[model samples]
Target: MASPRPFSRYEFLIAWRYLRARRAEGGVSVMTWISLIGITLGVMALIATLAVRAGFRADFVDTILGANPHSTVSYAPSQVYNELTEETYFSPGTIQDYDALAARIAAIPGVTRADPAVRGKVMATQNGQRGLGDVYGVSAEAMAALPGVVDPERASGDIADYDRGIAIGIGLARTLGVGVGDRIQLVSPDGAQTAVGTTPRIESYEVVYIFSAGRWDIDEARIYMPLAAAQSFFNREGVADEIEVFVRDPERVDDWTPQLLSAAGERGQVWTWRDAAGSFLAALDMEDDVMFVILAILVLIASMNITSGLIMLVKNKGRDIGILRTMGLTEGAVLRVFFLCGAFTGVIGTAAGVVLGVALSLNVDHVMAALNALTGGNAWQPEVRGIYALHGELRAWDIFRAVALSLGLAFVVTIFPARRAARMNPVEALRYE
Candidate 1:
């Protein structure tokens, strides 16, 4: 084992002095400036890219949670029956039991509310235009309990009237040329047969309110009506398709899902939004990972510039290095001196980059706005789904990761040139000068 040397303040001072003298030398090469600019740009790109990814991830999660219930319970495929003619679907049957189950689920820790829901795909038509939409049948109280649905103007007494009253998305209303007070026809795939064979059961509904969820898929493909009306329309009187549960903390939804399933008494399956919306979330994660890797390559390339700059410094100061060695400075001390110089260059460049990057990331929206204005409002909007506009969220961990990676790269870049400077023979260096 090597003995530990006493710390020397003078050694550090010597290192700093050598770095300052090199920096002040006349005719400093353009390569030095290029190195600094490279680092700055690399850091800026990394920060901006990560910020955008973080923003999109956050916005996507919020949009999904906002438009759908937190968790859902349904019968698993081939496990429990879902046929409209099942005994569970008759009057005075399992549909009435949902109220008791909802109460039981509500009593579970972290569970905020639970409601029965009926879901189906149906074709909606107004005038001559027809579009496919997801139909949800929910009780008036359940609709009120939902976060974004009820408002003063939109609320009409009780949700029971919602049996004949329906809420449609703004985009769908526009596409179909329908508005509040307009009647729309609904055709359910699972409607009861009238006589001889299959019959198209048709019902007209009055549009009561229009909502815009900012998500194109949801806003253009959903309609809400009372649960009983939907059950009657489908001829499934007693059973709901699923039970929707809202939780106090959405982050703990996975934890609560199993508990609710266990409480569902063996006839139902539980599904969290993480499961229902898995593909979208997975795509967002993959995008973030790929973007980060690409941006990190920029920083890696910048670190190479630091390495080249240090090599140039070593070449320019050969005679000075010879003099310092002749003055009894050890090779280790000489190495430390140039290493400090190179490392300090990295530190400064990386620090400046971090500051600039953070500023840009924090104000990305403003930057986008400025660009839009500069282009006379002709700038193309970012192609983002499920949100109103692009956003940037600066996470503390992301900033920390970027800084740490940059500093580490800078340190690694200093090593090779620092080693070469340490190994130079004083006699040969002086004779060459």
Candidate 2:
């Protein structure tokens, strides 16, 4: 006896024949075109939305990490050591046991580097321009370990002296209208009166190195000086405002915080970037959630097209269903054939959408550039900085989720139509003119 034809091949041919017949009908029914368009629009919207969210999260994280240390250890009440002012010339609080604390923290599994830092708020003035910026006094070696703290070639010579050198952010420098060899006045909050009763506590330093951390916050208001200078300015001797710790992985911030606190002893509290920038981070997360829900509606509306298209197919194929049932084909097989046809439409539409979405995500910058040219002005400037345009990195998980959702929605839309086709009475369908 001849072997029965493979079920897979038969199913494939049946699905293809139906698909081709629909296409050849010259002007396919409006419902069919609508369904295809719906799937295409839904898939494209999902992929694009996910890509933008991923990009925004990445860019925001980079900006935050660049501006602040991964984790910091400071005295709980007030980390600022206020006793060792330049006038008092008194010894300030020291680590008490610096070497021991360092050793204990370094032994922790994920600790990369731990260094002392002097933090103070100071008013910087260049010519008539003035701004309040953080003055971070760090050891030369410690400066090297901190992220985004590098001396640029143009200003290296200014900082060569070390004693009178100060590094200012590029944006800050621009606003102040100062550069290498320019004099800038630095005023500390603490001032003391002389024996005659006149307050005298102002100092001037030459603008040395200009650093750019690629973040508006850092570039707009950050200054670095030698630990000793900061110590003298803040009157904190042998003591530091905080101990900055670098970790191997930022995601493990909470894991390392407790370890740092233990090592810092009872006098200090450890704070992560997330803790310091809690509100900002929370806002970012909220933004992501809102965007996801809003964009998902676009996909949801597009899926309706799939439902309408499948209903139309069921009506168009009524006669085919009757013939197949009379030929001894089971209701289940008839149902499966139409289900496969709907799924095929979803698959093709989703594939095309993925390609289009990925291409758009990757070239978002170029697209913005063209728009800017056409508009003769900067448009689509959602980035943290106005200097550059926004671009999103496509994520694999996002793509997978998008395609799965599209196909799943297609399957759901096909069910009722497939079932109706299966339930058609062969005699009645055949009797109809």
The most accurate candidate by lDDT is 1
Candidate RMSDs in order: 4.8, 4.7
**Model 1 clash number:** 0
Would you estimate the TM-scores of all the predictions?
Answer: 0.85, 0.85
Per-residue accuracy of model 2 over 1-433 as CA lDDT, tens digit each: 4533434567767876776654545233565566677778777777877787677667767666654678887765534445566343333334645546766777888888777788888888877999888898887767665556563542344445555688888878888898877888888757664686645357788776787765666777788889888877777766777777778888768888877887787776788988876787688678767876765666666666656666666677778888888887877887788778777777888888898889888887787788988987556543344223467789898899888778777788778877887888988888874
Worst 10 residues of 2 by lDDT: 380-389
**What residue pairs are clashing in model 1?**
none
Q: Per-residue lDDT for 182-300 in model 1, tens only?
A: 88998876666767766777899998877765566777888898888887887658877778899998867899867987888676678898887789779888988887788778888
Q: Poorest 10 consecutive residues of model 1 by lDDT?
A: 87-96
What's the lDDT for all of these models?
0.76, 0.73
Clashes of 2: 3
